[model samples]
Structure formats: C-alpha cells, structure tokens
Target: MIAASDADKWKKALLEWDVTSLEEHPSSDGVCVCGQTGLLWMYTITNDANGAELFPIGSSCVNHFGRTDLNRRVDVFHKLALVQATANAGKPVEMTTEFFSRAALKFLFEEGAFTPDSYNYGDGVNDYEFLLKMFGKRDKSTITSRQGYKIRKLVTSKIIPFVLADPRVR
Candidate 1:
C-alpha cells in the first residue's frame, strides 16, 4: 500500500509509467488475475525509491486508470491490423498499405507494444467492428477478393487516405 503522504507521488509516477510489455492474449487459459477472462495483456513499470515491481493489467484496468496513450496505442494497433489485412488482400500494398502498416507497427514495437511479443488474445474491439462492416467476417484472411472487391472502394476512399494522413491516429 502507498503511504498517505506518498499519494501524490504515486499518482504522478503512474501517469508517467512506461509500458514495459503488451500481449494480445492472456497467459492463463482465459481469466485475467483480475478475474476477467479474455482481455488484452498490459504490463507496467512499478517503481520508486523503494525499488521496483511489475503488474499485469487488462483493458478495463487501464481504462479505469485513464491511460489515454495506452488506449490510443491499442486503437492504433487495430488500425494497423486492418491495414495489414487490406495489404494481404492487395488493397493498396502497391500503394501505401504495406509501407504505412510496417512503419506504424515498427513504431509501436519499438515502444514496447509487446514484451516478448505475444498474441495469446486477438485484435481489440474497434478492429472487430471495422472489419465486420467491411468483410462481414472478423478474420480478414477468410475474405475473398472476388467477394470483397467492392469493399476496396471503402478502403481506397477512407482507410488508406486516413492512414496516409495520420497513420497512428490523429
């Protein structure tokens, strides 16, 4: 427990705590230690004059803490995943889909998007909704070019231009 007098310091440190790791999946079969199952894995730096500690967190906890950057990164990851899927479909791989996705992912990876980099879970909520609208399926891999060619219009007109303007979320 933090000392009463140290409350401010703890809050400040928490606001600045670096993301040490992230995983798409949980280590346990399903439940987070926090007891929620099937959530994103996030690890934080726990430290001070006393030394250091590490904690595993879920999206709910991160949201509770108001960590906007963490949330934003997750958003960016979902966007990147979509960009990659579009690339696989040859949407704009020859244009900017491949380049932007690669660069965006590299930026996140360098910032510790995943420690030991695991995907035990999967893409976040925003990604699911977006893909569902475009492909009628959650897994982009299952989409067929013949069936999805018209979806390319949406990608070319919206997503590609969106990423080109601000790849990591404006």
Candidate 2:
C-alpha cells in the first residue's frame, strides 16, 4: 500500500510522465495492479528505478496519489462506457449523462442532426422542451406538423444510430 506522503517519491521515480491513463476495458473483472486490489480499469505508472518499474493503479488511486487530472478522464470513460452499453443494447439514449458527455456533443453536429446558426452557438443549438440539448429540433415550419412528427419518429428510431453509437431516443 502506497501512502499519500510517498506520492512525491513515486512522481520523482517516473522516467516519463508521472501518470498515464488507460482506457477502461469491457471486462469489469480486471484487477487494478496497485497494491490495492479490486476491479477497475488499470492505469500504468512507470518509474525509471531498476530499469523502469511499471504497475497499474485504480481510478480512485490516481487522485489519492495526486493525479487528479487522470481521475477526471477516468470519470469521462465511465460515462462513455455507460453510453456504449446503452447503445449496444439498442435502447434509445437521451442527451443526459447516461446518453452522452459534453465532449461527445460535437458528434451530433458532425452528423448534421441540426446545423447551428454558427459554430459558437454552444448548447443553444436547439432547446425543445422534452428534448432540450438534443441534437436537433423537428422544424414544423419547413415541414407540416404531421411530417415533423413522422420525421422525429424516424430520426429517433433510425437516424439516431448513425448519428451516434449511443442510443438517441427514450
């Protein structure tokens, strides 16, 4: 077990960056190689001592050992995992955390879910009541209300999968 006070020693021993984040693996059973044991994706901590000693650490240990930035990335990956799981299940994911992350918002734009008035529009792209922050709004003015409804249904069911790997409907 590494004590927090020894964190600096660990940092000083690193031949490379003090920390490196590994993407979460699909198997939750993988053990964290830090002195602590349990399932969490592994992080590689490499040190030059004795010709480069490397070991894996859990996401929690990243912060506990003073690698807060890596911890944030771990959180982002956790959300991504949730989104992917929902997508694989063929369920419709909303724009909430379970559906997507802020980092992933650009996917909708790239997919042409809705074109913003400008690049800097941010979350103001479309604010439909139930679908606030959703990728697009059903434009009734351009299409009749009935057509808009049908399009929404089709987009929610079909276009969404192509727009994002994550489910895009309730």
Per-model TM-score on C-alpha atoms: 0.36, 0.44
Task: Compute the lDDT of residue 65 as modeled in candidate 2.
Answer: 52
For model 1 the TM-score comes to 0.36
What's the count of clashing pairs in each model shown? Answer: 3, 1
Would you list the C-alpha lDDT of every candidate in the order shown?
0.46, 0.47
Evaluated against the true structure, the overall lDDT of model 2 is 0.47
Which residue ranges in model 1 land beyond 4 Å of their true spot? 1-10, 26-30, 40-55, 77-170
Highest TM-score, which number? 2
Q: Write the per-residue lDDT of candidate 1 for residues 47-101, one digit (tens) a residue.
A: 4444454445555655654777666554445455456455546656322333334
Which 10 residues in a row give candidate 2 its minimum summed lDDT? 127-136
